[model samples]
Target: MVKFGYTILYVEDVEKSIEFYENAFGFARKFVSPENDYGELNTGGTTLSFASKNLGVQNLEDGFIESTLEDKPFAIELAFVTDDVGDLVQKATSLGAVLVAEPKKKPWGQVVSYVRDLDGFLIEICTPVEM
Candidate 1:
């Protein structure tokens, strides 16, 4: 059997990326490599991980397009569900996250907003979707 495990974002600074998530979203740090080139966050069921761009380059023979705040965000996004969408969005922005959209109530009864992390990755902050 196979299962989804974690998502790793290649960042310029592993430590700072992990720190940002910890400060902005309150995820606890799980571990960091001795070289500080990689780290993981204890994000419940699926871990959220970060690796330095150098590490990513070492792993992938072909270089990849790095995310940057000056560019448009990638198509995919990491969504965090919270009871208070507005507050979390505000907190994230205060911690250097770029606000992409303000919280709005969806037709499905979910309040959702968007932000770009320090790495310029799109993040969706929202209330849990009712099934």
Candidate 2:
């Protein structure tokens, strides 16, 4: 059984990414490197780390090289569980987050809506219905 703790995303600019997470999602900066190459944001117990692409190479050894030919912008969808789905959606919209999908009740009895963050990552905010 593996427990999830954190997810790291490579960003073009760490400062801008941090500001987005803070202003949009209400995540606070928990830790940051002195050079500002990487930092962690805390949202409840989950931690999301943002690392700049240029500084990410520092983690690799000298003999190691990453192939840029296959490198491309990747898309990831993150689902966030919220008690008040409707309120959260409204708040997210007011914070300049783009609403990709309006909140809808799914067949599985969950209310969900999709939104895109500043970096174009899809985020699904959902609330489970009573069985």
Candidate 3:
């Protein structure tokens, strides 16, 4: 059966990205490869992983492109659920994540905000849905 798994982000430094998630969002580190080119984090039901840019290049013949500090984030985004969007925004920003949008209340009564991770990956922090 097909099921959703983890998302892997290509980064310059896997260890630093791993630390960023740990300090910014409180995700505990799962492990890092012995080669120091890959790392994973315990993000509840699904994992969040990071791979070195070199690894990405080695894996893809055409070489995959990724968001850069000089470029805008990719179209897709990773959404994180939290009770306090403001607090998480502060934490993410303090860890070098640039704020894309400020927290705002949606018509459905949910608060949501957007930010870009150190690698320019889009991230959304919002209150947990009661459904």
Candidate 4:
């Protein structure tokens, strides 16, 4: 059986991506390069890494690749769970994240919202309602 441990994302600016994740999603940096070409972020139980395309070859299987004849940006969606969806939404919006959805109670007993990161990756912040 394969267990998922972490996810990696490719960005135009690793430093800016790191800062956005840290401020918007409350992730802390595990390590960062002086050149800002790459960095790792710790999200409680998992780690997310950011890399710049100009730095070197990226492992394509990580799922952040976008193919275009010209250099076009590509991004993926990542979900985060929180106890207070409203607060997280407010924090993310304040941090310059584009709000895609507002906090709303869902039928699955979850209050959720969606936001786009600096790199245009979608993120879902949610709180599971008690059944």
On TM-score, the leading prediction is: 1
Backbone clash pairs for candidate 3 read: none
The TM-score values for the models, in the order shown, are 0.98, 0.74, 0.96, 0.79
TM-score comparison, 2 vs 4, better candidate: 4
Model 2 misplaced regions, further than 4 Å: 57-75, 129-131
Q: After superposition, how far is residue 62 of candidate 2 from its true place, in Å?
A: 13
Q: What is the lDDT of every predicted structure here? A: 0.95, 0.74, 0.93, 0.77
On TM-score, the stronger of 1 and 2 is 1
Total clashing residue pairs per candidate? 0, 0, 0, 0
lDDT of 1 by residue, 45-125 (tens): 999999999999999989999999999998999999999999999999999999999999999999999999999999999
Model 3 Cα lDDT, one tens digit per residue, 1-131: 98667899999899999999999999999999999899999998888999999999998879998778789788899999999999999999998999999999998889999999989999999998766
Best by lDDT: 1
* Model 4 Cα lDDT, one tens digit per residue, 1-131: 97677777767888988998898877888999988888999986778988886653544544445432243324456889889888888888898777888888888888888877766677889885577
Give stretches of model 3 more than 4 Å off: none
Error of 1 at 96 (Å): 0.4
RMSD of candidate 1 to the truth, in angstroms, is: 0.6
